[model samples]
Target: MIRTIDVHKSFNEQEVLKGVTTEFFPGKTNLIIGRSGAGKTVLLKILVGLVTPTTGDIFYGDVNFSQLNKKEMRAIRMKVGMLFQGSALFDSMSVEENIRFPLDMFTSMTWKEKAMQVDSCLERVSLGQVHKKYPSEISGGMQKRVGIARAIVLNPEYLFCDEPNSGLDPKTAIVIDELIRDITIDKNITTVINTHDMNSVMEIGDNIVLIHEGKLAWRGDKSQVLESTNDTLQQFIFASPFLQRLRAAALERSQEG
Candidate 1:
């Protein structure tokens, strides 16, 4: 699990995160959702050590990560995996080489061992074959799967995803969401995702954190979203007319019950 204690971030005169505190548990898909500039972006950066918090600490398990020195942080980072918003696969590398990049850089595993590990990750992500394919040779959804394969290639203890479903069709988005959820549960890894995809929220949001104006506005699972009376959360999640109607029907059924 990862915990942030009274975390804060400031850029020049403007404060981004304001004394925020939260815990992201392992073996579940922990989601961070908020409007633009609500500080969710900054918080994700802080969690992954891209930006240090000005006032507080981040903990990985029992270790207070914010206090770690650069060398110590690098050691911890080897156990971390990140799935970028754009897939971030290199155009020049084949799928196997792309997945093997981390192992090559971080591990002294023999060539055959690295090949086996890369193939295992590719199989885990349900991408058999296409080893020789480049990023451009595959579709967008396939590229995202390749990203997932590469992210978990080293079997990281902590996983972070930024806007994972940004540019996919609804159907493909769900597939990707389910893939992440399954991997998290199977590995029992601490997985934190920053996403705007509502379908992901309703489907795999085992632990959801809603940030508003640099503070934790709300926290709960998918089931609580429909029944929640929190105005900020309701306005954000049920923004569309279709969703509002769905909420209304659920409320009506609740009253009848």
Candidate 2:
């Protein structure tokens, strides 16, 4: 599990995160949700060591991640996998090469060994026989799967996904969501996802954190979302007229029963 202790971040003179503390659990999909510029992105960056927190601590399985030296940080990073918002596959590289890139960069595995590992990851993502295909040759959804394949090739202990369902049809997005969720449980990885997708919240959100104005506004699972009376959560979640109506209907039905 990963835990943040009263973390705060400042950009020059402006503060972004303010004493935010939370825990991301293993074998579960932990989602960070907030409006744009609500500091969610900054929090994720801080958690992954991309940004330095101005105050407080980040702990990775009892290790003080915030205080780690460069070498120690690298060791922790090796066990962490990140799936970027755009899939971030190399356009010129084949699917196999893309998946094998991390192995080549980090490990002393032989070419044959790398190939086998790549193949295994591809199979795990339910993609078959696309080893030689370039990113442009496949659909957006396939590229996302390739990203997932690459992310897990190292069998990381922690996984981070940024907008995993972005830029895909609703159906394809759901497929990606389930794939991430399943992989997290199967590998028992501490999974943290930075997303704005409400579908993802209700579907795979085992732990949910809502940020508002640089502070943790609410915390709960998918089951509690609809019933939550927290004004901050309710305002952020039911911002749309359709969703407001849906929530009202859901609440009314629950009252009737």
lDDT of 1 by residue, 184-247 (tens): 9999999999998899999999999999999999999999988889999999998899999998
TM-score of 1: 0.97
Give candidate 2's error at residue 112 in angstroms. 2.5
Each model's lDDT? 0.93, 0.94
User: Could you tell me every candidate's TM-score relative to the true structure?
Assistant: 0.97, 0.97
Runs of candidate 2 exceeding 4 Å displacement: none
Give the Å shift of residue 82 in candidate 1: 0.6
lDDT of 2 by residue, 1-257 (tens): 99999999989999999899999999999999999999998999888998989999999999999999989999999999999898999998999999999999999999999989998999999999999999999999999999999999999999999889889999999999999999999999999999989899999999999999999999999999998999999898889999999989998999999
Cα RMSD (angstroms) for every candidate in the order listed: 1.1, 1.1
Q: After superposition, how far is residue 213 of candidate 1 from its true place, in Å?
A: 1.0
